[model samples]
Target chain A: MEKPVSTSPLGQTLAVSGVSHSYAGAQAVDDVNFVVPAGSIAAILGPSGCGKSTMLRIVCGLLRPGVGKVMIGDRDVTDVPARERKVGMVFQNYALFPHMTVAENIAYGLSGLPREERRERVAQMMSIVRLEPFANRLPRQMSGGQQQRVAVARALAPRPALLLLDEPFAALDRSLRADLQFEFVQLQRSLGITAIIVTHDQEEAQSVAEQLIVMNKGRVEQSGPPAELYDKPANLFVNGFVGHASLLKATVARADDGNGLLRLASGSQLAMPGPVGFVPTSDVVLAVRPEHVKLAASPTPGALLAKRVLSVPLGHLMVHDLLVEGATPVRAIADRASESAELPRDVFVSFALDRCRLFPAP
Target chain B: MNRNGLPFLLPMLALSLAGFVLPLALLGVFSFVDTSGSPTLANYQRLFADPFVLSVLVDTIALGFKVVALTTLIALPITLLYWHASPALRRVIVFLTLLPMLTSNVVRTFAWIVILGRQGPISQALVELGLAPAPRSLLFNETALVVVLAQIELPLLVLPVMAVIARSDGALSAAAQTLGAGPWRILVTVLLPMMAPGFLAGWVLVFAGATTSYVTQSVIGGARLIYLPQFVYREVGVLFQWPSAAAVAFVLLAATSLIMLAMTAAARHPRLAGHA
Candidate 1:
């Protein structure tokens, strides 16, 4: 694949502070705040109906926040109308102008420019998206992936300070989505435009974004690098949301400042390293990721028993759903080439002590 | 074409033969033959020769164009608003507007007459409000014809456009705005282009309804003002010229068909699309 025209154009900073919105008296996005660095790809990840859509509108200035200030660069655009904000947005549906050709759709944002300039910009965008061949075609005639590229090219044509994408790849198949994701990230990096993408998909977020902002119920649970957020999450929501994790009910057995002891449901005391801010007798939930949960071929210390284990072959690896007593099903990943793939009926599963997270019980 | 489905289509086939095909066949015969039963082009020749007839046809075409223009202007905004309305309000607006389509056209014409008559509410209000001199009729004029025809055809235009808007996935206007086009620019560049099908359907419906409507034009136009439908009605009713009337009606139908074909062709052209 040709490297998509990466020239660091120096994207502007986008900061939204204390942004909150409500629909029909019900809170949708509440007091959400974040600052996206210039030229970086940021993702706002959430589940369905979690106010991500509402927050998207607010960030783009389509809907005024009930209380908040939005800033692009150094200027405060909280009260500015959507049209004057110079923010480029790609809607979830791609929202390509159905009647306009691909060229016209890209030229739509450049209307204020002279005719020659607009045409030149459209041509440039078509080249960047590698859609020159389809420039004369309508959006309906193109595949889902082609339309998505056109949407990105159209938004990037005007060179807005910030580009907002609201789940632009939700319609594509897995392979196509992955290909476009890589191309778009390259295009975004080459263009060096600050972009904030909203998606409910964790994998897409992890693959496409350099910085991930996890949202739940109109609140920002955590905002950091995807890998950092995955390894060390702030709370229970972030732990489960950023990636798959199993939770076990536990209570504080003892604590000081450096290390804490947790009493598991089976009356076993496990030591957890942290500031153990909770009270001495307070309850907590132990969060462990699937990859960190290892299935032992033989009985190992600090290992949990499995009533039944089933390995699902998924090309490169297998997902072993281990039935741990007094806990929800624990899913562990084992290499397809390993002997652990052919597990016995009853086996022992253990968690990596260093990788476990402890959050106060919700 | 399935044997089982063929039986289900019988009622539609029967209705088409009886209601559409049979009358069209009769109109064709009548249009060709004179009252004395001689097949000649005398009626068509006379229709083309007479300046009065040509003017009436031209006036009817103009009226149809006006009807399409006016209905689109009046209905597009309302239809867009209806599309954006809450579910409860949308139901109420739909019921109120489409209620007229269910009511008899003759009844609606009479209602318009009462409203625009010399002693009607409009005239009375105009006199009382000192906007007009004494009690004058707002009916029996070209302007009055367009106004009434637009009202009668507004819902027809609105419903089809509303259907098109409802089927869209995202708010194109919002997308356009974020892309830096202002509201007016968005309307011109994005929404209007996206709504091309809606406008095309609305224009065709309003044009056909306006050009063929006899009751509304006669009652609203009164005796002084004459349109193609009124001219056709007079040919048979007063002059007792069935062949001439049938010929005129057929010409009107042909004109409507040609214009509709032109419109459909125009809709295919990207630059010319939705220009109407």
Candidate 2:
């Protein structure tokens, strides 16, 4: 592959500090801050209208922050116009100029270079995206996946300090989205470019991003590695937004040295290892992933009583939606031990205590 | 689909055949016959033979082109302003642009007469500002005709261009800016090409309307200048020559149609044809 167009050879760090912007009387992004290390990928994951889009615009200099600083590679670009910021952005629709050919669109940012040099750079970018065969095709004539690659090629041709994409895979079908996301990760890895993709999909975020920043109601709920955030979410919002989990209301019945006893609302008492930070008789919520819950064939001493409401059998596993304590619903996924044997409606559910987490009640 | 649509299309087709095509056919036949009712090509031959008629024909077509160019230049900034304006301000702009069209064309053309007359506001202002030695009439001139005609055509161009701007993908310009294109470069490369289809449609409307606008030409241009429409009027009404008037009318129609075709073809050239 040809050398990456970035000037630093290695990508530069992107730092956004204390950035807060409001529209009219409503807050859009409130004191949001984060850093993506050089040559790494960060995903800003949030639901629609949660201010991730606003943060992406602010970082790329398209919309100036109402209050704060944006630094790329140690250069403070808070006051710079978007054209002079040396940042490349791929818009949600890909926004390829309908009038220009693929070669012209890719060369749009290289206007300052000599003619021969610009042509060479356009060729290089097309080659990087595996689009040399479609250089003359208009964006309307290409498929969604090909158009996305063209947008990436056009943005990277400028050799910008940082790359930002807004909902990069939101326009593709499920099968195509997976393939393009894989290509994007491989391409970013080969170029060693620092990039940020804003998306509302948690699965897409978890699969493609090294660092995942989850935002809610215009504030950062949590920012960490995907595995870290999924495994140890900071609060109720993060716990619910990052991945699937069952949160059961409970109270601390007793506290000891680095270990605790909890009384679940279902009238069951269990011992859990701590660093559980609450005092005795404090209200808390216990969070457990579906994969961590298993069905007990018969009632055991440590198991809790529950009735299976519904069972969906996939070829590889059966997903059971169970009501714990006869009221609160919890989901569990288990291997389909046999194809024809059906489990009893009345069974006990047990947790893998080491994988479960507890959070103080709201 | 054809069977389903034909019933809905009957009224418009009958109206066009009666109102437009039949009259044009009559005019064509009138151009072929002489005063004595002998079938002769003298009416057409006589037209090409006259220097005055040729100049008048040339001037009217040139006048149409000038009005189209001026209205396009004037409509762009208004479209841009409307694009950036708030919702309330946009409503106000639409009201102001359409307000003139609600008035009669004769009234609007006469208002231009009051503005450009010898004792009108413009001449008085010019004399007071010491730009002119005396109050001079700006009416009865080609410049006055072009300006007044462009004013009449302004709304035709502005509305369509505004609609195109509204339908445009705003992200394209934002994307261009992030690609390091300045405002002027983005306008030239991205925005203008996208607006071409609307502009071309507006051009056809303005060019056709302005060239045939006999009221504005006669009121603002006066008898001091003679365009093809005025020439045709003089032939039939003043000199009582029906054949000659019919010939001039047909020539005007052919010339206007030819120019519009050429303009459409040129606009469809590879560069501007991207969106068109």
- Summed backbone clashes in each candidate are 1, 0
Model 2 residue A305 lDDT? 85
- Candidate 1 has which clashing residue pairs, if any? A6-A190
Q: Which stretches of candidate 1 lie over 4 Å from their true place?
A: A1-9, A253-261, A266-280, B1-7, B83-92, B237-239, B270-276
Kindly provide the TM-score obtained by chain B of candidate 2 when compared with the true chain B: 0.93
Q: Tell me how far candidate 1 lies from the true structure as C-alpha RMSD in angstroms.
A: 4.1
Q: Give the candidate number with the greatest lDDT.
A: 2
Model 2 per-residue lDDT tens digits across residues A223-255: 999999988899888888888999899999988
Top TM-score model: 1
Q: Quantify all predictions' global Cα lDDT against the true fold.
A: 0.84, 0.88
For model 2, the stretches where C-alpha displacement exceeds 4 angstroms are A1-10, A249-276, A279-283, A296-310, A313-315, A322-327, A337-340, A344-348, B1-3, B83-95, B117-124, B127-137, B236-240, B267-276
Predicted candidate 2, C-alpha RMSD? 3.5
Docking verdict class for candidate 1: medium
Of the candidates shown, which would achieve the greatest DockQ relative to the real structure? Answer: 2
For model 1, residues A48-85, the per-residue Cα lDDT tens digits are: 98888888788788999999999888989899887777
